[model samples]
Target: MVGVKANTAAKFRLYPTADQAERLVSWSHTCRAVWNIALAQRVWAYGSAQRKTLQAGEQCSELTLARKEHVWLRDLPAQCAQQVLRQLDAAYENFWNPEHPARSPQYKRKSHQQGVTFPGQAVQIRKVSRRMAHVRLPKLGWVRFRLSRPIEGTVRNATIKRDGLGWHVAFGVHRPEPVDRHVNAGPAAGVDVGIACSVFVSTENEGRQRPDTLTAGEKQRLRGLERRMARQLTFAKKHNGGKYSKRLRRTIAQIAVLKARQARRRADWNHKLTDDLAKSHGIVAVEDLKVSNMLRSAKGTVAQPGTNVKQKAGLNRSIADQGWFEIRRQLGYKTRRYGGELVAVAPHGTSQTCARCGTRDSENRQGCGRLFACVHCGHTEHADRNAAINILDRALSTAGRAGCAASGRGTAQSTRSPHGQGSLAGSRMREPSSNVTAA
Candidate 1:
């Protein structure tokens, strides 16, 4: 049956007491230990069977590790222990499959994760009359869930994770809704993505720019973390016994936290931007940018040795914080839900080329210019707005152009530049020894 699938997230605001936090951490540790034990048992079974294959099969099923055998193992819940075995089996199966040759099976370790989910076990949800959850874990008696929204479908599994800021529980549910249709308004809209102004919309809200100040702050924090990490690394190198300083370890953990914060901020903005676009516009047009390639080019360009780095670092940070991929992902689903469609147009020359006359020449455009003074048609506009206009025009010219992967082709795609902003002509860049694909 044709159906729609959506993940309805319900985040609960909870202030778990220190005691509750400790209990949760202990449970997490127990889960990790159980998983490692199960993995070890699987390895032993494979060896006893005189087979080099790591895939969990009949041999692994025959080898059962009891809780009483190990004190740490006994601390884990029964369902958690079972899930560990299942995960080991699944991991082994994946490693054995030749089609996925990149991933190989490896020994489980503590740092892998401390969470477990059992598909077979029935997930219990207890809402007490006065208390939040009637029955909690052995130590955490009654945890509260300030559930902002209702959960739909049959929740198949639940996972508790220690996020950077706090603890969170994610529920996986099975939902079957009607298929969402993709509809577009009579008019088309264009978007310009950049570091200065994260997003510049050119339609309902003309000339409106969404700046990423939060992203900038996160990067500033990241720069501080990097300095601390570097100093710690230096200290470790000088230390004997092949030992690392405790401060170094703590710095790494801090860096991880900063990364998580940055990720959260990016995710938040992407959701907001996608929601706005889906609700306001029928068709959304955006430039196709190769951010991964761009970042690779900027790695060795950082000049400074410490917190005081090159200016390009800020640009690099901004690009990452923009969360273009996350925006695309959210838009892909949200557009269908609200009867809208997203289109990616060729980014080449969209910024430099005149949207009014369709004339493209880099020579006429000065170094890193933001004004489009077209010699052929005398068209002038803000650089981003001009690009946006061309994006909208490109969307209108080609049907199904917004979501087509091949939209990266065409005369709008660029060379040398990441965003394809400096194409000399309305022609694809000539590769001396490579074929130019569609934009």
Candidate 2:
């Protein structure tokens, strides 16, 4: 535990017995209660004259006193409760830090609290069979879970959580990195993420690779479920929310199942695509997209009502269905793991700029047209394929600072802007920098 470094989490489904399930539920409740109470203490203290902030170590001592008063709290593990306080302390730190994206820590509700984490000493995993294993917990002993795969290293900690599907356990085991060096034998490629297609890849071996999006049947099914759930909720509310409660639950569950399936398919597609890219490409260039910003709700305020809100909403769904950010994230890690480079260039004029003539005119980009016919040069190609080629060329034009930095070259590096702007003033730096739009 002292030397182990966290590499990744290995999650497995947990099939708890009825008695154990009740205990796990109780533990989740206790953790949530502790978090809310601790948050309240710090918040109230903030308004006081002294304005002293609470600390986890101090709270750990207070927890002992509280357990003496409320015997029920003692039933759960001490480390679990302590971890909750530590989590709160970390949250407060984040709130005070200027660089952190932390907001005010709010009280955790039972439905929202994921679960509790057990420290290294408290988590003991033992293999029961080739495909099954048992983990010992604080209150519930020997809960059986699928083996799924071998735990690579010593289990440092375990997080118990429940999702729409079911309960599961995630082990934070630290596996050491291998010392062998990797040499890239594959070619460089550029990827353009879009709504119509999940991603259009421009690689040397294959002129262009475009993966299919969610099937029409799947989209139709999701829409049907959404409508059915909405109708059931309306009926339940009209009936004072008691008589149609069962029917409402059934409808909600169906929607959850469909959403979960959709998520799984996207994740599978993303992983496979990334794996191939990482394995075959030494340099992967992608447009740095702010997905959440792009997907912001189109419903504007009262004064200026949004235009084409419904159309925008549908487009947002398509953008989300592509999982643009997820693909980028996976490529980042996978490229590093495979000793490759991940270059994220600015996404400003990739579509409008022709790959042939480098034309930046709007006429070069016909609206809703898959074909890109450059009026200046008369170069015609698939719009996505054209964009992908531009992205790759943009990434390769600068000798790629990402690769230089990863290979430990920290110095003045020039970057070419995607908009065909002149080179930015070069400066000596310790880390790699890419052409990203300034906020």
The candidate scoring highest on TM-score is 2
- Per-residue CA lDDT of candidate 1, range 189-295, in tens? 68787755566677634454555434667778889889988877777777644366777777777877776676676677777887887677766777766666555
Q: Count of backbone clashes for each model?
A: 9, 0
**Which candidate number has the best lDDT?**
2
TM-score of predicted structure 1: 0.65
Q: Candidate 2 deviates by what RMSD?
A: 9.4
lDDT values for all models: 0.57, 0.71
Which digits, one per residue and each the tens of the lDDT, describe model 2 over residues 300-411? 9999889999999998888877777778767766776676777888898998889998888789877977788899999998788888989988887855645643452122
Q: Which clashing pairs does model 2 show?
A: none
- Tell me how candidate 1 scores on lDDT: 0.57
In candidate 1, residue 389 scores what lDDT?
82
Query: For each candidate, what TM-score against the reference?
Result: 0.65, 0.80
